[model samples]
Target: MGGRLPLFRDLLPRGLLGRSVLIILVPILLLQAVALQLFYGGHLDVISRRLAGGVAGDVAMLVELLQRETIEDRSWIFREASWRLDLALAFEAGARLNAVERRASMPLLPLEEDLNRALEERLRLPFDTDWQSDPRSVIIRVQTPDGVLHVEAPRKRLFTATLYLFVIWLVGSALLLSAVAVVFMKNQVRAIRRLAGAAEAFGLGRDIGTIKPEGAAEVRQAAQAFNRMQDRIRRFVGQRTDMLAGISHDLRTPLTRMRLALAMLPRSADTEEDLSALTADVEEMERMIAAYLAFARGEGTEQAAPADLVELVQEVAAKARRSGATVEVVAPSGLMLPLRADALRRCLGNLLDNARRHGRLIMVAVDTVSRGEPGDEAAPAWAQITVDDDGPGIPAAGREAAFRPFASGAPGGTGLGLAIARDIVRAHGGEIALEQSPLGGLRARLRLPV
Candidate 1:
C-alpha cells in the first residue's frame, strides 16, 4: 500500500491549479456517470421496451388481419397501415422467412434487444430484424401461414429522443462547471505564483518590494505575512549595517592616528629594524580591519541584476594576472544571471587572491551545469565557476572550518577570505565550497542559479 501511494501521487497533477481542477472535475464526472446509469440504464430501458412492444403489437395485428382478408383487399390494408400506424408493409406470396438474410445484432444499443424481445413475445412466429437495411427504418420479416410478411417500422418508434437530450445536458453542464472552476482557480493560483516569484527574487538579493495581496482569504493572509516578514528582515539588516558603519569609522580613526605616530618616530640604525617590523604590524592590522569590515558589510544593500558571469570571471582573472599570478581562464562567451555585481566581484576576488597568495599557477573556469536527476527538464541549472591553484590545499576535515571568520590557515592572512566569499555567495542564493584541486592545491567552487 505504501509503494502504491507513490505511484498514485506520480499519476496526479503536480500543480495546484491542475489538482484543484481535478478535485472538482472528478466528482462531477462521477455524478454524471451515475446519473446517466440511473436514467439511461433504467428509465430509458423501460421506455424503449414499451415503444418496441407497441410496434411489435401493430405488426402482429396486421399479420393477423392479412391472414383473414382476401389477397385483393390486402392492398387497402397495407395502405391504411402506412397512413395510420406509420409502418410500411408488403406481402410476399409463398415466400419463405428462411431466405431473408439476418443482420448482426448491435450489442451496445438496447434498441435491438428490446425490439427483438418484443417481437418474439407478440408474433410467436419466426421473424428476423434488419437494422442496417435502412438508416431510418428497422425491417422486420414475419413468417405467416400464407407467405412471408415484410414490415418496415420507423426507427424513431423504438427509442425516445430524451436519451440524447439527457446525455447532452449532462455533458454541457459538466463542461460549463469545469470552465468556471478553471477561471476562478486560475486567478487564485496566479496570486500564489506571484508571491512565490517575489520570495525567490528577494532570496537572491533582488529587491522586488512587497507583493500586493490577491486571491482567497488564506492566500491573501499568507501574502500579508510574507510582506511583514520581508519588512522585519530589511529593517534588521539596515540597523546592523548602520551600526557596522559607525564602528568602522571609530576604529579606522584610531588606526590612522597610530600610523601618523609611527611615521613621526625618530629613526636610527638600531631601531630601524624594529620600526620596520612595527610598520608591518600596523599594515597587517589595517588589512585585518578591512577584512572585518568587508565580512560585516556582506552584500551591502546591492540589488541583483542580470550580469554576464563569464565576463566577470575573465575580469577577475585579468586582475589576478596583473597581481603577479599566472591565471588561465576557460569559459563560454556569455552566461548571464541575476547577481549583485560588486558583491559577486568581491566574492570571486577573494577566492582568486587567496589562490594567488598561496599558489603560483591559477586556473579559472566557468560553465553551466544541472544538479537534478537525469532527464529532468524542469530541474534548475546553475552557473558553475571554479578557481583552482597549485598551492597547498586544506585537508577535507578542516575545509569546512576555514569558512569561519579569523580561521586563516596561512601566514599574512586575515582568515576572513573564505568566510567573506561564502557570505557574499550565499547572499546571491549561491554556494561556495573548497575542495582539492587537480592542480594539487585548493579549488574554490561557486554555483549560482541560472
Candidate 2:
C-alpha cells in the first residue's frame, strides 16, 4: 500500500484549487461507482432472475409440446413461439451437443448464470448456449427426441436497456458536477491568487495597495492577516528610517561647524599641512554621514515603470565616460524592464563608480537572457547587467565582506558603495553577484527579473 501511494499522489492534481475541487469531485465519483456496483450486483441480479424465470417457463412449455407432438404440430408450435415470444426454433437432426458450455470460455454477460439456472431447472435436458454466435439474441441448444432443439431468443429477455441507462446517467451527472465545481472553485480561489500576487509585489518593493478580503472564511482571514502584516512592516521600516535620518542630520551639524571654525582660524606656515589634513578628515566624515542617510532612507518609495534597461545602463556608462573613466558599453536596443528608474540608476551608478575608481578600463554589458529548459519556447527572460574592469579584484574570501557598510578592507572607500547597490538591486527583485572578472578584476553580475 505504501509503495502504491506515490502513484496515487502523482495522479492527484498539483494546485490548491485543483486539489480542493478534486476533494469534492473524487467522493462523488467514488459514491457513484459504489451505487452502480450495488445496483448491478444485488438489485439487478434479482430483476434478471425474475425476468429469466418467466422466459424459462414459456421455453419449457414449448419444449414439452414439441416432445409429444407430430411433425406438423411441432412446426406450428415453433412458428407460434417465434412470433409471440421472439423465440427462433429449429430442429437439426444430427448435431452433437458441445461437451463444454460456451459460457465456460466466453466473457460473462449480465445474469448469464441466472439464465442458465432457470433453463436447467425447467427443461431437464442437456443444453449448450451459443454465447459466441449471436449478439442481439441468445441461442439455446437443447438435445431432445426430435434432434438438437435450437431456440434463439432475443438477448433483451435476460439483459434489458435499464442497466445501460443507469450507467450513462451516473457518469454524465458526475461530469456535469465536476465541471460546475471547477468554475465555482476558480471564482472562490481568485482571492487567494490576488493575495499571493500582492505579497510578491510587496516583497519586490513595489507599491502594495489595500486588499479587499474575499473567498471562504479561512481565506478571508488570511487576506486580513496579510494586510495587517504589510501595514506593520511599512510602519517599522518608516520608523527606523526616520530615526536614522534624524540622527544623521544631528551628526552633520557639529562637523559642519567644526569645518567653519577651522577655516576661520589663522593658519601658520608650519601648521598649514595639519589644517589641510584636518579639513579632509571633516569632509570624509560628511561623506560617511551622507552615505548613511541614503542607506537609511532606502531608495525612497519609488514607483516602478517600464523603462529601457539598455538605455539605462548606457546612461550610466556615459556618465562614467564624462568623469574621465575609460568606459565601453555593449547592449541590445530597447530591452525594457519594469523597474524603478531612479533606484536602478543609483545602483548602476555605485557599481560603475566603484569599478572606475579601482580600474582605468571599464566595460558594461547589458542583455536580456532566458532562463529555462534548453529549447523551451516559453521560457521567462532575465535582464542581465555586468560591470567588468581591470582593477585588482577582491579575493574570494573577502568578496562577501565587500558589501558590508564601513567594513575595513579598501584604503580610500567608505565601504558603503556595494552595500547601497545591493539594497537597490534587491528592491527591484534582482540579484547582484561579485566574481573574478575575465579582465582580471571584479565582475559585478546584476540579474533583474523581467
Candidate 3:
C-alpha cells in the first residue's frame, strides 16, 4: 500500500493549475456517469418496454382480424390497419415464412430486446424480427396457418428521443463547468507563482519590490506577511551597518595617530629594533581591522545582476598572475548568471590568494552542470567554479573548521578568507566547500544556481 501511494502520486499532475483542474473534473465525470446509469437502467428501460408492447399489440390485433375474414374481405381490413395503426401489412397466401430468423445487429438501446419480449407475450406464434432491414422501421413476420404475415413497424414507436437529449446535456454542462474552473484557478495560481519568484529573487540579494496581493484571502495574507518580514530584515541590516561604520571610523583615527607618532620617534641604535617591532604590530592591527570590516559588511548591499562568470574568473586569474602566482584558467567562452560582481570578485580573490600563498600551481575552472538527470528541464543547473592548488591540503577533519573566522591554518594569515568567501557565496544563494584536490592540495568548489 505504501509503495502504491507513490505510483498514484506520480500519475497525478504536479502543477497547481493541473491539479486544481483535475480536482474539479473528476467529481463532475463521476456524477454524470451515475446519472446515466440510473436513467438508462431504470427509467428509460420502463419507457422502451411500454412502447414495444403498444406496437406488438397492434400487429397481434390485425393478424386476428385477418384470420376471421375471407381473402377478398381482408383487403379492406389491411387498408384500415395501414391508416389507423400506421402499420404496413402484406398477406401472402399459401406461402411459408422462409426467410431466416434475423436478430438485431448491435442495437445501441434496449429497444430490440423489449420489442422481442413483447411480441412473444402477445402473439405466442413463430415469428422473426429484422431490425437492420430498414433504418426507420422494424420488419416482423408472423407464421400463421394461412400464410406469412409481414408487418413493417416504424422504429419511433419503440424508442424515446429524450435519451439522446439527456446524454448531450450531461456532456455539454460538464465541459462548460470545467472551462470556468480552469480560468479561475489559473488566475489564483498565477498570483502564487509571482510570490515564489519574488521570494527567490530577494534571497539572492536582488530587490524585487513588494508584491501586490491579488489572489485568494489566504494568499493575500501570505504576501502581506512577506512584505513585513522584508521590512524588518532591511531595518536590522541598516542599523548594524551604521554602527559598524562608526566603529571603523573611530578605530582608524587612533591607528593613524599611532603610525605618525612612531614615524616621529628619534632614530637611535638601541631603540631602533623596538620601534620597528611596534610599527609592525600597528600595521598588523590595521590589516585585522580591514578584514573584520569586510567580514561584517558581507555582500554590502550590492544588487544582483547578470554577469559573465567566465570573464570574472579570467580577470581574477590575471590578477593572481601579476602577483607572481602560476595561475591557469580553464572555462568556456561565456556563462551568464545573476551575481553581486564585486562581492563574488572578493570571494574568488580570497580563495586564489590562499592557494597562491601556500601552493606553487593554481588552477581555476568554470562550467555548467545539472543537479539532476540529463535533459530534465525541471531540475536546476548550477554554475560550478573550482579553485585547486598543489600545496599540502588540510585533512578532512579540519577542512570544515577552516571556514570559521580566526581559524587560519597558515601562519601570519588573517583567518577570515574562507569565512568571508562562504558568507559571500551564501548571500548569492550558492554554496562553497573545501575538499582534497587531485593536485595534492586543497580544492575550493563553488556552486551557484544558473
lDDT of each: 0.88, 0.85, 0.90
Instruction: Give the Cα-based TM-score of candidate 3 against the true structure.
Output: 0.87
Model 1 segments more than 4 A misplaced: 97-108, 371-380
Clashes of each: 0, 0, 0
Please provide TM-scores, in order, for all candidate models, with all chains considered together.
0.91, 0.81, 0.87
What TM-score would candidate 1 get against the native?
0.91
Task: Rank all candidate structures by their TM-score, best first, as comma-separated numbers.
Answer: 1, 3, 2
Reference-based lDDT, residue 116, model 3 = 85
Kindly list the per-residue Cα lDDT of model 3 for residues 171-270, writing each as its tens digit: 8999899989999999999999999988987777777778998899999999899889888988887787778878888998999999999999998999
Compared to the true structure, candidate 2 yields what TM-score?
0.81
lDDT of 1 by residue, 62-87 (tens): 98899889998888889999999999
Off by over 4 Å in 3: 63-73, 90-108, 120-135, 141-150, 266-280, 375-380, 397-401, 404-407
Ranking by lDDT: 3, 1, 2
In terms of lDDT, the best-performing candidate is 3
Clashing pairs for model 1 are none
Worst 10 residues of 1 by lDDT: 99-108
